[model samples]
Target: MASRPSISLWFVMAADLATVVWMYTVGSWLDHTSKFTATSTLGGHHILVLVLAALAFATLAVLALITDGFTNTTPRLSLIKNLACILSVVALTGLVALILASLLSRIVFGRLRP
Candidate 1:
């Protein structure tokens, strides 16, 4: 008998593709703005690719949460599910903190007092 693809796997692939597309499109647009600096040809491409790949992996991590068998059912042979939850929470919280910091930096760009 042939095995079918798990829902989690499908979502993971989808998420990865979405992340790459989103990162590529947005990064390209951001690159066009004069305000954004790309120090070198290699550095610019590397930065964009690195950011997109990280987002893609994060998408996979999140898919693990949404998959029914992975999150709803108890693991019979391991503690991977429990670990996933903990790691996912930490990753999400860190992302939130980073976003807040970015916003704060933008708002305070010209207001820091000596």
Candidate 2:
């Protein structure tokens, strides 16, 4: 028989799903809005988006690796890793959201730059 998932598991799943929704919605919104501006550090929207996605992936992966390595070893490390994981997930969610938003913009605004 299959086992039931715990509350924490459900929470995590819900949170992750919410993150995806937020990203897609925000992306759509930003794409339609005319007031948003790009900073020099982030460059133009297209390049900034790719950079954000890459950063999000890098941060989540690194934190996950650290958490995996510390699991079953130390309590302090476990707590720290968990915190880092949470933070990375949030950051990743935001960046990914931007990427998704940019996708909508690209589709509407044209993909090639003149």
Candidate 3:
């Protein structure tokens, strides 16, 4: 029988999705707003880069989690797998930070930082 996802997993997925959306939306807003007094910092290329970067990082995090789910008896592979675990933690933490900052700014400043 197929098992349902744990509540923690559901929360993790929701937070990750929220962060990705926030990063892109805020990045785009900032890019556009910069045009008024400053040169457009994040133009189309920059937006693409930010989006791709977030996706890449998030993918790496997911892959890391999946890889850790395996159990094997190889030292070299274990080392690489451990590294993936570390990278995943870092990526997830960064994403969370970005989201928190965005949320706080919206709540306190009443603007989306654009």
Candidate 4:
């Protein structure tokens, strides 16, 4: 008989799905707003790249989590999981910083009108 998957696995799957949905939502919003000006378009493009990077890191984290879950005996899998976690944190940090900077620029420069 097959064993059931772990609860952690379910959580990871849900988080990944949420990330994809969020990426789609943000991309749609950016596409709509980017037509306002060259600066907004440029900022939107940068934001899209950061979002994609975060998603990629999140994917890597999920893969590592799954691999380590299945083969907990291996030291290599542990290393991969650790690396993925670290990279995911870094990606998230960069994404947040980029977003804050974009918002601040828009506010200070009065570009928020668009």
TM-score of each: 0.31, 0.33, 0.33, 0.38
Residue 71, candidate 3: alpha-carbon lDDT: 31
Candidate 2 clashing pairs?
27-101
Residue 53 in candidate 3, Cα distance off native in Å: 7.3
Structural RMSD, model 3: 8.1
Better of 1 and 2 by TM-score: 2
Per-residue CA lDDT of model 1 for 11-100, tens digit only, reads: 544544553564455545434443332221122452444354455456445545554434343343125434433433432332344456
Pairs that collide in candidate 1 are none
Model 1 residue 43 lDDT score: 26
Give the CA lDDT, 0 to 100, for residue 86 in model 4. 54
RMSD of 1: 9.2
Better of 2 and 4 by lDDT: 4
Query: On a 0 to 100 scale, what is the lDDT of residue 98 in model 4?
Result: 49
Return the candidate ranking by lDDT, descending.
4, 3, 2, 1
Worst-scoring 10-residue span by lDDT in model 1 = 34-43
Greater-lDDT candidate between 1 and 3: 3
